[model samples]
Target: MLEIFPVYITPFEQERLIRVYLPKNYNKENKRYPVLYMHDGQNVFRDNDAIGGKSLELENYLDEIGLEVIVVGIDQNSEDRKNEYCPWVSGEYSKKILGYTSSEGGKGTEYIDFIVNELKPFIDNKYLTLKDRTAMAGISLGGLISTFAACRYPHIFTRVAAVSSAFYRNQEELEKLLKSSDLSSIEDFYLDCGTKEASGEALISKEFVASNNSIYEILREKISNVKFEIINDAEHNYFFFRERFPKILSFLVSAK
Candidate 1:
């Protein structure tokens, strides 16, 4: 059986959903499993909330396959999502397209702190978890946040799975940070993007391809335990993410 917990984050007064999937043979007396903190909580488990029934269907599939682990889904506040996702904003994308005020920036760091310091402790205290082995996963803007957290707090998150990361201007900044930081002991990292036109508004455009390639190239050079996959015909949407969740989960759990 799965356990669903609705947690309220104090910083933004946000109610996030935490979905916990227990293995069919889960025995509290026998084993402890790793935890995966995923972004866009509303779209991760079921289609009932935001995606209009186009959710990833991850919980159902993982439960059916009996891959037991705790999945915490952090839902984003749509209005402040871009500010919370993008680490660094350049040009007018933040204001013109994303609709963010100039003063309401740098929330990504706070979001990360809330996760690593606040939410993790709360969950660890309440559930059976392997604290030392933790991972963060997300798609699109959420993917950008995951990568930023992994890079900034390498010690906190041992694994990062970013699907179709929205590099934008932050991509270059992350590359520079990774180049300057000591990443020898960092944990596993996974990145995947699709080539289809429908994958994402940014991915389908030719301009963003260079940014994505640059980010991948830099990670390849600096991070040792990393995997990069470019899906030829896939697009940026919940459907594609659903298809890829099993593979991502398999890789993440294998490290445990």
Candidate 2:
């Protein structure tokens, strides 16, 4: 049985929904399963939160596929989302779009800390989880944040699934992090984007694709366990991401 709970994260100053889908074969007698932490909680399962009436239907699809991994979705605050997604605020593009006055902007580090220190510990205590076999994933801006978390805190998460990541801001900083950071600890990293996403008013720009491809190319060179996919005839929206959710879930679980 799948249990959906509303968790109040004090550090983020918001109440986010956390949905856990327990497979039918889940047993206390057996070993614990891995966990995948996903962002954009509202758009993951239902259509009401997406553009059209068609939803991702992730839970139903995963259930049919007989995957036994637990999924935790964290909702993003619309106003603070951009700031929380990007790592550094000193970049020109970040300052223009995010409107951060100070050189150090965005509470991304704090948000990740909240997830790693507060939320993960609580979930670990409450559920049967394989601590080492953990992953983080998201789409668009959320995808950007997931990638940042993976690069910054490689010890906390072993796998990452960044779908259509918005990498318009702080390209040099991200490159520095990738170069200096210890990526050898990362087990798996997945990057995917739609070709048609280039033409959209979805807050995506040329810089976005450039940065995304740059990061993808760099990761391909540095990380051995990295996978990249580009979906054709697809745009930057929930529909495309919904279609790709199954593949992402399969990849995450199969890596275990």
Candidate 3:
């Protein structure tokens, strides 16, 4: 069953809906489960709520695998997604990607603070969770934010999966932030995308292949375990993430 509730993101002063996907018999079961916090809640489940796309079908995936874990999906505010997902940088990138000017986006650190301080404490107190077994993940721009979250609160989130991250948009600034972060406590990272993500006819605002590769290299240099890959036929869409969700979950849950 999915538990839904309204959460106030104090930093943004906005109330976002968060959905929790609990395992079968959660109320009857006595076991505590590891938690996976995901961004873009609308697309995480419920096909009807998907923003012009299909749902990830996450509930079915979990049932088929028989892996009982808690998934907390945090919905994003559309108006501030760009601003909040953009990594906290020193404003080096010219506020532009594919000719579109990005907002100052320096507020991402504050956004992460909201999740770490406000949302996480609430979830931990309300649910039966394995305190240390936690991960944060996202796709595209949300992916960018997840990467930042893992770094900003390495002690809070031990694992991270940033799929097809829009790193190319704020490459320079984001790299600076990653390089300066303390990743000593982070357990693992799954960073990947498709080579075609950078192609001409692929319809992406910016090709993020090289940027993600750079993120992998930078992370590997500082952190011991970092998994990077370029899927053969993947794209910048939910289908790629949905197809790869099983492997992603396995890696993340194993880290616990």
Candidate 4:
């Protein structure tokens, strides 16, 4: 079942919608399950509430498979999305991607702070959760922040998934950080990008795929259990993310 409620985000000093997914048998058994925190709350569940009327429909997938886990979908502030999703200011490549200079970034640390320090504790206390078996997942810019969270607090997030990640936004800084950070605490990581992500048309963007590949190369050395894939014919949208959600979710929950 899915439950929706408004919660105050202390770091942003704003109230946001949080979508929680409880297992079908949550009330029937005394089982404590792992927790998976996801970004883009609106697009993580039902389609009616999603942006552009498209979503991952994660509730259906989880319920169909009978996966017993708690999913917390944190809503995004549309106006401050870029700022909250990027850990640093727009890099050169990011500027080029938009065909102009943009300075909407650098608040990602605060957003993550709220999740790690405030949100996680609240979820743990309110639900019967396996506190140690926590994971995170996101898409596009959301993917960028999930990766940053894993590196910043490796001990807190044991598994992570980034699909169609716009790592180019902070590629240079992230690559440097990944090379130096200790990722030994991350037990499983699933990273993937589509060949048709740039324009979402027939034309393929080698540059986009290369940006994700570079991060994968760095992670393979730092993380012992990392998986990377270049999905064929996929684009940067909820439709494609939904198609690949099963694989990503499977990888994360498999080991845990």
By descending lDDT, how would the candidates be arranged?
Answer: 4, 3, 2, 1
Candidates, ranked, TM-score = 4, 3, 2, 1
Off by over 4 Å in 4: 200-204
Best candidate per lDDT, number?
A: 4
Query: How does each model score on TM-score?
Result: 0.86, 0.87, 0.91, 0.96
Local distance difference test, per candidate? 0.74, 0.75, 0.80, 0.90
**lDDT string, candidate 3, 1-256, tens digits:** 7889999888777789999988886889887889999988989977788887787888777866777789999887887777777765424343444545544566778878887789888988999998888899899887888887877788888889988888765688778778999999888889888866645555442345666888899999877778998887677777777888789888888733
Decoy 4 TM-score against native? 0.96
Error of 3 at 252 (Å): 0.5
lDDT of 1 at 179: 72
lDDT of 1 at 222: 72
CA lDDT of 250 in candidate 2?
A: 78
Best-performing candidate as measured by TM-score: 4
**Candidate 2 runs further than 4 Å off:** 27-29, 49-54, 93-105, 198-207
Better of 3 and 4 by lDDT: 4
Clashing pairs in 1: 199-235, 199-236
Model 4 has a clash total of 0
Clashing pairs in 3: none
